[model samples]
Target: AKVYYHDFVVQATKVKRLCTTHNTITVNGQFPGPTLEVNDGDTLVVNVVNKARYNVTIHWHGVRQVRSGWADGPEFVTQCPIRPGGSYTYRFTIQGQVGTLWWHAHSSWLRATVYGALVIRPKEGTSYPFPKPKRETPILLGEWWDANPIDVVREATRTGGAPNVSDAYTINGQPGDLYNCSSKDTVIVPIDSGETHLLRVINAALNQELFFTVANHRFTVVGADASYLKPFTTSVIMLGPGQTTDVLISGDQPPARYYMAAEPYQSAQGAPFDNTTTTAILEYKSAPCPAKGISSKPVMPTLPAFNDTATVTAFIQSFRSPNKVDVPTDIDENLFITVGLGLFNCPKNFGSSRCQGPNGTRFTASMNNVSFVLPSNVSILQAYKQGVPGVFTTDFPANPPVQFDYTGNVSRSLWQPVPGTKVYKLKYGSRVQIVLQGTNIQTAENHPIHIHGYDFYILATGFGNFNPQKDTAKFNLVDPPMRNTVGVSVNGWAVIRFVADNPGAWLMHCHLDVHITWGLAVVFLVENGVGELQSLQPPPADLPPC
Candidate 1:
């Protein structure tokens, strides 16, 4: 209904955390950046000036950019990154989506510091599906590293090893009073007694899935990834790196300060992670104030163990659509894709300091046994539109190249994956079903798969393997949850279905940054329909160069 214009400056700033200072790249110099609030049916025009040292591109994490691929920024996927000292503009409109989404740097590890919230409310004449809350708050969960995040990834790339984990988890940008030198700036959420508040929680960590909760408070989940769901009450919820959750909470407890904290949800066995927690305080204004300069300690919540798979599975399976809708009753494309970690044997003459992993092999990841490699010469969408040859191939396998016991013991010979820039081609408006099966190549682990450009309904999830004969009967067609991301449990399977109505080159990949860097990704190219609007718009004049 309206147009929102903004200017973002990507520049370096001195940021202090955990008693150490580092020069970090940020958007407009804000730690978590500025929150951009817009209503449904509104257009956003953002002019981004890259004043930082490295190249930059901003991706609207969960926004459905309809036919506007030029504005859907994903480094080399849709467009090239804006180089240092250059500028670019992103323009798109919000069609029917309304809830919590976010924006972040899509290049390298810059998103660790350059990220913020993008909230979409209902259109002019529409309202929320559930009752309105007294007020709303955006709670962003992030990770804090003692060293520069870019350096961490650079060292990992140089050595062909996994990146180092962060020093502490974060609520917004602070490590909160639980850590040293953070009590003065701890984030405090003030609320009135007996009033309900809406909390939009986003997990922006680079490589971890987090479990978030508030002390002595249980919230009612209403939406996720911008889609409303059947209101369910839960004590805690889990979020992958690229996921968002919207919940309603009431201030029914005694008026005092209670801790809202987040910790790692580590389902992958033997994977290294940060064991520390981040927190904020929910301060009830109706309670008596604490003595000056001598405040009482906030009450902390009890969270599940780091490897609590049962609790995570139960919470994930509880999501359902608030209303009945037509699921893909008939399928057009059924794909059984195997995704997990693998190993790449180090070259005999390699002389890097960290070149060794397990048994003299470097770490790798894959889908269909193909490691995804991004093109540095041109963007995928650009090459597809200009009919350029040799940039990429549309022969990404429809199924795993070789299939065995997906969740059982895998041989060492089959642990190596080939790297390529490949995409799967599809017709517009085709119904699709993808069975995302987790494997035990290195170790059975939980992977949250995120698909860009479309939201799909989650039909069913089960452990071990997904058998069509037995599992197909368990699909929930009546009220399956629609979401942009789903966490396939460790050694488990999840089935999702969506219509290929958007014509563009879109990416489907694991949300963990480390896994993506190791080649756990694929792309889909949907052909255009017989209409102008069904086709992607021409490339913008200010599109960045490769």
Candidate 2:
């Protein structure tokens, strides 16, 4: 009901972490950028000015753009990036979504530092479906590199190898007391006894899933991806990049400082990750201060091991809608897409330096054996709207080109994926179901697949390849969780359904930056509907040029 205007200036700033200083790109000079708070149904007009050296685009993650597809920024997906010294205005309204969502830079590697929370409360004069909390806080879990993150990704891109892992994990931009020279600046959340607080936890890490827990406290999860869920209590929560969880915590423990920490939930076997823990303190207002020249450490929580898949599975399975949802039963499009990593045999023309992956190969990923390639001359949306040709093809496969044991030992011959800018076409208002099957070509890892401009219901998920006959019966048509992002389990599959009512070029990809760089992505082009109301709005005048 209200319009909010903001100016986001992306610039370079000197930030020190892990006892080292690095020049970091940031928005408004904040490492975790800026938190945008609005009520449901409010309109946001963000003028993003690219003062940094890199081209950039800001995405309002989990905010269904509806008719405003041009503002759903994903670099070359919806619109071109705003070049350095250039500016672009993104205008879109948040519709019926209310809970925890976030905003981040959609361009290459800039989101490592240019990201923040987008908290949506109930509309004005309206209240939450559940009881009110005493206060609210945004816990942004992020990754930090001692070296420049852009440089890190750039080197990986040049070598065609996996990027270097982050030096440390972060909580609100600090590495916390666990690391050197961080105790003084560890983020502290103050609370009063017997008061309940809402914690909007967002995992903005570039390429890692995280497990979060507060010492001596259990969380009652109330919402995720800006949608309310049936409240469930859990000791820990796992979030893939671009995912969010809203949980309520009560200050019922004895008056003391308790550590709230986040660490990597590394699922890929033999893959390296930052094993460090980042922490914040939940301090009671009545707690006594430390004596002179003496410091007291907060009570640390026992976290799950990095490879704890059982806990992750249990936590994921617990999510359900607060009530029955209108899950589409009659599917107009049913896609069984295989998602996994591959190894491209090193090309002799490129030389050894360029092919630094396993056994001198290049790492790649695909959906249905086609690696996604972004167009350089024009964005997908622009090409589609302006009738531009040769930008992309509408021949993305509905299923794998060659079928085999998806979760079994795959042949080395199938490890290479062909690269193309392909998109799947969908009619307006068509009901769709997609079986995201994880394969074991190179190795299996959890993929946080995210879609722009739409939120879908997660009907069911299970380990191993998804079978229509056996797994279709496992679908939960009623009370299934609705989300904009779903973490396809390692060597597993997840079935999701949604109505293709939003007309636009929407990018669906793995949220892990490295995996997306390896081309685990696709686009869905939803055709315009009957009238103006159901069609995509016109592109803004200041839309960035390619």
Candidate 3:
């Protein structure tokens, strides 16, 4: 295995988009930052220098990190944020993972512009499970706000309401020709006749799910979240934030330019979202060029509607492992966690501006009724390792404190969630299954739940409340698809199982940044097992202090 070293300078750079220039926080002054390519079993040592004003930490999303919990960089979960003018090194190995993964800032709202693709090819002397594509491209779908993202979130935090929706959806940091003043900067993807290409599609958007399509080409999905899947062809695909989909596209259409487009998939009934489309041109090498003075437009694909839940459901249900897999049948720790939004009554001392949510209430979210709050004094991992007190409590509930009809009209009393820095303790080698139930507390919507440090098999998913008596029989234990993230369907539930083999303080939360900001998260503190190999590594000397 090879060890790769890199320097990431997180600096503020002035960038123009949507006819306005703003100081955006970026890595190495690159908008989408840098793409790091490595093979499976390779080690990465990234030194992140926080030159920007905001505290920052980079998370290697979907990279298992193995025994390197100290490098799993979720602020206040695994490690403290690298403060301004501070530097921290993340050194970890990519163990047994291949295909598309990503890296992004794990701090407050910084990931809006601070993110990148982490591509893992097969290990040296090994070949891909499928035929090699003639070319590979990373399509990063993101969001852009006219105002400063940090300021936007700060205002939301102050007002105790939902933040302003983004101004535009982006494709590789460009709003594309569909928006004003973007035609000249629209990304163009090149292709040759009859050749196959790999598209590593990543959804790095902060608060939106996206539907992606090509004008005249079909995609054979081969992998997701760095794990191989049974190849299936589709005309459209949906990706929630922090999810990656690997699809192979063949240049079988007429020699012309077609638009590769993405639009929002807003499942929340009345929630406002960026209903704009961002596009890139897929041009064939043999296509004719337009006259110098003439303007030609590429053919655009018909994307799904913003509220197309049926399409999203179908796309997610199609994923399967290519081979019969090992899904744990005997679960040791079974947990039923409710994930959804809630409303907190405005305090009497607070003014109207601070209670701007529906009916003068503040928006909140939770898992099993506990709204996760991060400790400011120290990180959870550091507190646990050093025997520090008052950082967090290991009392996260395994189920909702009070059981009600999850998808039904919830009682007003249950709308308020308690806030705390709580974690669930687990043995290092226990087999676990979690039934992530989506509730209709405020409004039902798909929550892309992501777990750090391990990939779990998505056993099954269905709408309405989860009944283990009936749903357990529907589990696809033989060939369940493995992923680091799964989208809990709107007003529904999903069952995922995995072995708790890696020792770490792993944060599991909604991929939507806004949801996490409102406290839709939990931490799993897996105790170290016997011996050094099964235990977490010691913290680095340069680890950032709170």
Candidate 4:
């Protein structure tokens, strides 16, 4: 197959709707970015030019770069930031993936405006487990803040506490009607009567899981996180941050425009984040009428409350222990880590001991007591130069002796780089398992943890602590969704297992960009094996410079 190439300029654009004007960042001046369609074996070359004021880099989320780690995007990890007015070309081949993935900015806050859908069609003559829909649409969910997002983070870091919530949640960049006194708040999904539409939904929110539903309609979810699952029908679908779902909506019923909407699924007892942010609207257009008329407000559906624990638990269970296919068990490696929220005092000065926190509070989230520290430079490439050993630590905590210490004095200090750290080493085809425990120290914030290069199975999850005897009995050693990311419940714990079949250095981090910026990130060192996969070939000479 021939290689495909595209050039895009990221810039700001003005959009007018419902008598209101707003500014948005776009790729090549198009909102929701552009779509990239390719086959399984096709090569993709994208030249991303940063025309915006801030630095930027683009990541092919969920696409395993494999040995092409140079193309992996995570500023200061695989590559450096593309400075303002600078350009970088991401080159990689779409190897074994065939489903719905996405692309987004990797630099700080730039993703707020730079993102798009990446659709990989199956190889010739290949088909999915379920029937394909006649029409398909990508519904990218995002967060919107009228104030500058950078400023929001800046203030939070200075205050040493949680940042203020966003002004609204957006579906395809529109905060469908739900906000008060907002005239331009609406999401319009045009659909023909009696036809089915495939809605590809991506929850790109920084800090919240979402519950989505449409008025007077049930959807059959057939795919998730770029992988096809056996189709299942439901009235509402719950998706965590960084997760994606593909559902088919039947337009056979009364087809006047009906509002499709999404809202935060976090409970009131959790962190103090926004509760009533409406992300998008599904507008079902009816068959043509004789004359044009104003579209009456679609009847608003009764949405579930923000803190409905039963609904949340039931929704989560629906996606658990999937029944359709079985994954091979000749696994490769296993690992364990605990996730929790705490506080560490940042020195009043850069390297001084004298420190203070927000209202004298020092709060943060981490995996283990050791918060991940993102290197100032791309550590993977540096490791490759320095012999790949001694760059990362293999001493990650195996298990937390105290799993749920709500009153424990969790460390409130940031991750300061140790002068020397032992690097993690793993051979190809290693089966990996990571046990994540969430401790309720200072605040109980839910963390959506994500890993790069490969997806894993959620073996088990439980609340209020991990007991060796009692917890092991409830393990669902069945067909959990093979996911690249999973949520660590507030004041609870989760155990995920996978195979490190892809050979390359991979990143694992909190999906919340805010926590990621605060140093919640790590790298996996997949050592080269004997035979065909022993070593990786360097990138091409003309590889776009990021």
lDDT of each: 0.87, 0.90, 0.91, 0.68
Regions of candidate 1 where Cα sits further than 4 Å from its true position:
267-275, 290-294, 349-354
Evaluated at residue 107, the lDDT of candidate 3 is 92
Q: In candidate 1, how many Å is residue 49 off? A: 0.7
lDDT of 4 by residue, 417-497 (tens): 222222355677677767776665554456778888777777777677666688867666776766777777767778777
Q: Per-residue CA lDDT of candidate 1, range 181-289, in tens?
A: 7777788887889999999999998888999999999989999998889999999998999899999999999988888988888744222222366888898887688
- Taking every candidate in turn, the Cα RMSD to the unseen true structure, in Å, is 2.0, 1.8, 1.8, 3.9
Error of 4 at 383 (Å): 3.1
TM-score-superior candidate, 3 or 4: 3
TM-score of each: 0.97, 0.98, 0.98, 0.87
Which is the winner by lDDT between candidate 2 and candidate 4? 2
lDDT of 1 at 15: 90
Q: What number of backbone clashes does candidate 2 have, counting pairs of residues 3 or more apart or in separate chains?
A: 0
Please give, for residues 506-533, the per-residue lDDT of candidate 3 as tens digits. 9999999999999999999999999999
State the TM-score for model 1: 0.97
Off by over 4 Å in 3: 267-275, 290-294
lDDT of 2 by residue, 1-546 (tens): 999999999999888887777788999888888899999999999999999999999999999999999999999999989999999999999999999999999988889999999999999999998889999999999989888888999999889888998877899998888788787778889888999999999999999899999999999999999999999999999999999999999999988888899977864422222337888889888877732221666777988888888998899999999998888889999999988999888767989999998889899999999999999878999999999999999999998988888888888776579999999999999999999998877654689999998999999999987877898899999899999999887689999999999999999999999989989999999999998998999999999988
Count: clashes, candidate 4: 16
